[model samples]
Target chain A: MKVLVPIKRAVDYNVRVRVKNDGSGVELNGVKMSVNPFDEIANEEALRLKEKGVVTEVVVATIGVAKAEDQLRSELARGADRAIHVVADQDIQPLQAARILKKLVEDEGIDLVLMGKQAIDDDANQTGQMLATLLGWPQATFASKVEIEGQTARVDREIDAGIETLEVDLPAVITADLRLNEPRFIKLPDIMKAKRKPLDKRELGDFDIDVPTLEVTETRPPSGREPGRMVKDVDELIATLKDKGLV
Target chain B: MSKILIVAETLSGELHPTTAKAVACAQAIGGDIHVAVFGSGDQGPAQAAAEIEGVTEVLYVQHDENNAARAATLAPQVVALAAEGYSHLLAANTTTGKDLMPRVAALLGVPQVTDIMAVHGPRDFDRPIYAGNAITRVQAPGDFVLVGTVRTASFGAAGGGNSAAVSDKAVDAELPSHTRLVEQKTGGGDRPDLQTASRVVSGGRALGSSENFDIIFKLADALGAGAGASRAAVDAGYVPNDMQVGQTGKIIAPDLYIACGISGAIQHLAGIKDAGTIVAINNDENAPIFEIADLGLVGDLFEVVPQLTEKLG
Candidate 1:
């Protein structure tokens, strides 16, 4: 089966994001960008499924600006068969992104779509589920383990309560959680080979895009927490808790 | 006034406490709050939802398809009920909400705001992005129905006193058969849930072994707080994945949080930043956790944890 993995070019997970002084959005000019961590895990899972012979091919797709091609190339280097870059100069919300993916799934005749549960930038956590609904397909979000047997996929999800196991038929959507797998590092030979791989370019207008209903009015730093005084020892700590009625 | 519909979260036909906290957020929004309880077997959760003081009405939806509480089934029902002139649809930002609400929004052709932490107005709210490192104020257009999830940790549970009316309701929506729940394996038994616990004690990789984790659990039991773990500890198999507290894990805002042997990563800090009082106990005085910890102690966790547990006892 052909698997489609949707990746995002997001601010590096380790960077300390700063809001623009104008209250427009977070400052992204010249900031370090990389494949979203969870999406990287998704890419890794798709690659593993191919290695296990469960998936016949792996294709990675992204909806972002021209600069997002860099992320697409990076995933290609990680062993995806090809990449699809839908260039969008404007901000694409989760709903629009899902709508675009639905078109791609139909156009590509894809079976399984693996993606991150949420992008660290928007933190919306909506695309996978939205796409599943629009297609009337099954979904497994925050998946830690995915197993394929014939036309069915058994997924283990990490949830607030604990691990939940679900079984869904093929042509399902699975969003990767952090523990899905440790993604492999790109090898020099693979990077060179990726240079020759197929990279298809498409326009955001090529598919139907929904107008966004949510608008951002302001962006700001979280209220800072001041470091309080430290106690001398266990006695002092216990005394402080008692004094504050925390204990 | 905006009419609000809260999707009550349930497990085993019982109301989850997070539903009350979502009610608190609705109360803040100043709306005619109605909670929709979807269950197949029991009406207990619907009666419980009615007791949340600010709730105006409880609508109980019963169907055999609602047995597993799958999002694919619940989303269509929620969308159908939301057609009754509800202006806003809300759910707690738990796994169920995160899984279910976006589908509702997509079906309704509206964009959803996840993890609403503050309510500035009916259309305006504050939500965290980049894992709570930055906060953004979002506004939904008044022309369309709004769908969002309340960050239960950011608000206290609505007090229970008044009894609102509960009524049985039926929704006509086509449910799918593609997704099926195999089973759910829960851990951290007999402990207060980490997300809503008033106090929490979390351990890190420094705990070394699962056996050593007992000391942390003992301290939690002594203080009657929930026990959590850093991703490092969970990855090392010192604890189960459910005990994990970090960006990818549970985002908690407890009254007091004690970090034992955890050198705070940005992701770990993100989860606990909303906590009321943070206490760090690490042998390394300069661990990053100390920077934000309201109270810091420099000591080995093995000795300090046992001593602290004894002291609390």
Candidate 2:
């Protein structure tokens, strides 16, 4: 079985995102970029599957600008067999991303598509399930534990209620949650090896996906919270809570 | 006027309260709101959905294949219902809605506005991005059916008073068999639901271990509050993922929120920003949680929590 892992170049999780002064969008100048944390978990899951001999090959793909090749190379260093970069300079929404991925899945003859549940940037949590819908395949989102058995995979999904287990046939789409696996750090030697690996480049226009227009009219910081006062001890805290009728 | 269709979230015949919050958003959008209850072996959830104040009708779609509420089967049914000339489709941004709504948008060939925090016009709304640090006002094209998920934390649940008409709607959509529910394991049994609880007491990594998490639960039980945990506590294996309260976990807007030993990360703050009055009980006086907390106590949770719980009792 072959697995295709789709990743995105997003703002580093540690960076504080700020809206631009003009209210157009977030300021990305000189901001640190990394593979989305959830996507890294997806890559880790695929690598573990390959190590277990359940997967024959692992492919990592992304849709971004020229600078995104760095992210692709980073994934290759982490044990992806190859990489695909569909070069799109402009920002793509979830629908277009899913359509492009659908094309890639067909062209690669992929048996499984594993990706992040949500990019920390847009936080849409859509593409994986959308791709599954377009392909008429089963989807298991927020997967914490995944085990492959013959032609089926058992996935433990984290939902609002609790962990729900599901069995989906092969050629399915699975979105990785935070607890899926902690990604491994890349070594210097592996980085050198990844430099020589095959990295194929394609353009967004190659997929012939009809993109829709969603306009961002403005961006702003959240409303300010009130300044707080502190109490010296538990007694004072209880007094304050009772005064506010919160206790 | 926009005609809205809300996909009611249900599991094992219980109508989730998140559905009522989505109804509140639909009411704000100003439409004839019809909620579709799928996967219910009986009509109990549908009847509950009909009682939401702004709901105009309830459509009960009962089928054996929908017993699990799998997205692969529900999306096609929702799309078929949207084809009935409805202009908008909405659901609450819980796990079920987050997993299900996008597929419905993909099948309808429309872009989705997720976690709608505010509504401006029929096609314009505000939603949070970058984990609620930045708010973006987005406008969808008027030509397509608008699909969105409501930020349940930002809106109150619609009151239950009006009795809406309930009808059985049969969809001709084909259901898939590739996905099957194996089982489910739920935690925090008999406790108030964290998402809808009026008061919540959450612990952090400072709790040390799963056994140490008992103090937080005991306090919660004493106050009749829900028990939650910060991502750090959940990551430290002190609690299950379902108890996590953060950007990646459950975003809640309880009336009173107590943080024990939690040094508020920005992501955790995002989940409780809408909370009424925030209280922080951390040994570290300079912890970031104190920045947003309405009342702060600088003391060890081990000592402060039990003392507070005893006083409350």
| Fnat scores for every prediction | 0.86, 0.87
Give a tens-digit lDDT track for model 2, residues A1-247.
9899999999999999988999988999999999999999999999999999999999999999999999999999999999999999988989999999999999999999999999999898999988998888899999999999999999999999889999999889999999999999999999999999999999777986676768988999989789998989888888888988887
Task: Give me the overall lDDT of model 2.
Answer: 0.92
Find the 10 residues in a row with the least total lDDT in model 1 chain B: B10-19
Q: What DockQ results do all the predictions give, each relative to the true complex?
A: 0.84, 0.83
Backbone N/Cα/C clashes per model: 0, 0
**Where does model 1 exceed 4 Å of error?**
none
Residue-by-residue lDDT tens digits, candidate 1, B1-313: 8999999998656799999999999989998999999988699999999999899999999999888888988999999999999989999999999999999998987899999999998889999999998899999876688899998879899999879999999899999888999999888478999988999999999999999999999999999999999999999998999999988799999999999999999999999998989999999988999999999999989999999999888
Total backbone collisions, model 1: 0
Give candidate 2 regions above 4 Å deviation. Answer: none
Could you tell me which residue pairs clash in candidate 1? none
What residue pairs are clashing in model 2? none
